[model samples]
Target chain A: MPDFDFHVSAFAWVPETSRGWVKCLRPRWAFEEAGFAYRTTRLGPGEGGSDGYRAWQPFGMVPAYDDGRVRLFESGAILLRIGALSDRLRGWDDAEEATIASWVFAALNTFETHTSRLTDGLPGAVEAVSRRLEALEAALGDREWLVERFSVADIAMATVLREIGETAVLRRHAGVSAYLARCLARPAFDRALQAQFADFDDSRVA
Target chain B: MPDFDFHVSAFAWVPETSRGWVKCLRPRWAFEEAGFAYRTTRLGPGEGGSDGYRAWQPFGMVPAYDDGRVRLFESGAILLRIGALSDRLRGWDDAEEATIASWVFAALNTFETHTSRLTDGLPGAVEAVSRRLEALEAALGDREWLVERFSVADIAMATVLREIGETAVLRRHAGVSAYLARCLARPAFDRALQAQFADFDDSRVA
Candidate 1:
């Protein structure tokens, strides 16, 4: 019942492997980097399926955000909103901001879109994911980050790459693997991952 | 070269079926809605694979944008930059802008991601698309556009829906079908569609 400036929705618990892998970590990482204090509203059993939750999150997905004035869903959108509100995370200029947006889309639409389907164990999915990873590895080249500096784009991309971290397809790209290591090395990322892991119940380990 | 205020990348030619379906339509539609006159840099064969094009567009995809000041790739990102620049297409307020961003991600990450995979004809893919489409239909109840007014969110969603327009999966949702029709009925969409089709050669009819 406290008047928290920012509130992000998450699940009450997730399986063991999914402990720190929830999409909610995106917002949590952003908030940590921004040095912002925010509260989390964890959904109970069947809450995500309720009509009220649907009104907030059209797809019953977690990581929806409310910033006192507006409600926003989609981790990519929420990340952008967080960047806009946080001085530390925002780009230096409008053009830099556009670059950030471009990388965000690349991470979600271009990369995650393919990586998410790999679990299906389809040949086509493997090929598709491989093609995109090659492009991403090429895109990364020698740049330390997706944009000028560490931003939400890296947060998005790193999380996506982490989801498929153990795959040989991703392991082949040494530069990408190194890049992921650098991103995960950030203290903020550790804070965010631990926060999400803390929310899960040890009794329910899937 | 003429000093055009804005420029967008596109393919010099695509197959007949893919003519209007090219993602360049997204930016063209946005420009039309904004009443902005922009030039198109049509990529000839092998150009998308070139190092220069890759520098501008990491994935070497079409619909990259340049406004003399900054360059950006990804249709969703380009749409957002257009919204920021155009008075007509942008949200009325900052909060409304956040809403537009949310829907844009929903269209690209949520909907297009699944629809794109359907061409592979995987069962899991079909079920995923159906679930998301049902949510979309339910969320879209009694609404003409994704946001308050017709914005880039509509452009992204409309284009994504149109890609799967002929599929029974999409057609099953009456509300979503009507929404797609409403979006296509726009003069800007028509203009953008024809503009893309005009760029393709008649000989390539795939």
Candidate 2:
């Protein structure tokens, strides 16, 4: 793909706290991992809800993708599509693809749901998060990645675990902590995170 | 698929409130719409955490699917895989497929997230759910479905909305209410819901 041939909606300005961790980086990482070239179309987070933005993403979220061939809004869906572009990051078989996708959904919905409660200071919520983390730790036993290799499942689940980042419960699971470390150490993730921060800085300068 | 060739792990007994509307119904609905044959494997919800179940679904959740060719968990991922089986419930082109996928994500993650608060009775939550409902209402504007046709997006979304059936916020959006009605009216959904309920009934008897 040529420069600007494919456009992905990115936050023109994410708050400083969420700078390197915005949802947009999932697809950026996928693009980098798959070595697919693309460009960002920045819009304010609030502008995400505007009619123009909603045309691409109905819920007014960022990281929608478009090219001559396809337009997609969900970052998970976008990452899956990008994975389809290169065999480097995913399995070629139907069973393999389904396994990878199942983990993606688990990361986003199940594991991600618990992250919301890790810092809420409610005993019930804290317990809920702990139970989920234990389950994850058990599943990851002696494996570097969720599946046989580092695929979109890694990109999705690791991104969610990345949000937990040395928090109280996460600190207790040495295996999980090590797993997240391995995921973040990937060069593709480093590039994506760097670009996200760089984009925020450039937008501020403008 | 032969007898027991494909297995969907369903609740051995879902509570009466969730019987027909269990998460398994999403794939069941998808399989029905696509007219693919499959079978269900029953296990208690807690039994879902057993070694055998955990091998298939890490989270011990119901609605895990396995054919000789594919095994998938996560209702959303399962529905997407089913959509791939036949264009009967999805778009033909890449762009169209992306459009359908975006709505599926919006339904499962965005819209479904807010539904958790509809009955929580917290002023803040109630207001948040209301806001999301309004956005969904605005997006639906005079459309029969999220995209031009009834696809897995509808199966995924309508299933979520059905969870909030006749809630305060839902009643305000007659369009969404009617959309759910239209979705439930589909023969595929009716068959799926009935089978799910029958599964529960059979388990109770056994």
Candidate 3:
């Protein structure tokens, strides 16, 4: 396999609690799922906010990538770039690709926003998330994946949904929960999860 | 110029205060900036939650687009698609395009989130917004735009920043404030803003 000159970034010290759930895993899972050989650099603990870090990631966020040319941040954008290279993840055509990319934004700006609020037990959070999930559930309606086949859109949306897991709000929607389960059941997600865990503590193997 | 047969959605009735500030303006401004001919559909007041609305927009958000090909929501995605078709908004090349795309996400998922809270008078909202603004300020230091030349990144970032206006947090960051001024000064933004106001009640021409 040709090593894709994709060098990404992650937090050096993600506490065990949030290690498996950081946003960096999005790119990792995308690369793993697309069978793209990529590597990552671990910034020092809490170094994500440093000036050096901010150069690549203006908001001082994680999971920026350099494909031996463009060094860009935002997992959504990175995943889209990766998706552009791999046909399966890239979707069938320009319109399909944009639709797929839209879901990634939906995950970040909608589903995840509500899910995070739900987790924090914020007011009216469940209702907000459920509304979005209801739409997603109806869209899924026994579909095996989001589009024709599993694409980068699922990688983005599932990662956000995965955070809800067997939680209260998630448990209320059987179809959505099942969809989440199916997404998590992917070997790519497992490998990505393992990789994240491995990055946390050297003793663990991905 | 030929009409592009692109149909977008927006609030049928935006109150005087937010008439021109609706999210739909992102795509409207984008289309105008790219000089693309398009039209829009107005969903009745609070009709964003309808099943028909949710079909194209899972979260039932405004600014969904159907361009005879792909139907999608998320202004970031829509802007990227529009940017892809326009050289001025698409940035210089592949790397530049992805970087511009990343900024769009930053605007939606990061900057906008902060500004929303700041508007709500949420605790520590100013500080939160300031941090991101600081990073943004650094990036735009001694520069006219986010990327080498003006691109879609500026459009996205400027729109979000425009929400804050010459307000508290923004007032403290002169450079960032000035950068936003440069973006909104564009004739396209002026036209889009005017078009949005035209969609509102006679009481507000904002």
For DockQ, the strongest prediction is: 1
Candidates, DockQ: 0.71, 0.68, 0.65
Tens-place lDDT per residue, model 2, A60-98, is 777889866888887778878777766788786777788
> Model 3: how far is A26 from its true place, Å?
0.4
Instruction: Residues A14-88, candidate 1: write the lDDT tens digits.
Output: 766777778999999999999988888888778898999998899999989998988999999999888888878
Q: In model 3, where do residues sit more than 4 Å from their true spots?
A: A1-3, A201-206, B1-3, B45-50, B201-206
How badly does each model clash, as a count of residue pairs? 0, 0, 0
Tens-digit lDDT track of model 2 for B83-196: 766668868777778887777777776666557545444335567666777777788899998778889999988988887887777888788889889999999998998889
Measured by TM-score, the strongest candidate is: 1
The best candidate in terms of lDDT: 1
DockQ of 3: 0.65
Clashing pairs in 3: none
Docking class of 2: medium
Error of 1 at B128 (Å): 1.6
Weakest 10 consecutive residues, lDDT, candidate 2 chain B?
B116-125
Model 3's CAPRI class is medium
List the candidate numbers ranked by lDDT, top first. Answer: 1, 3, 2
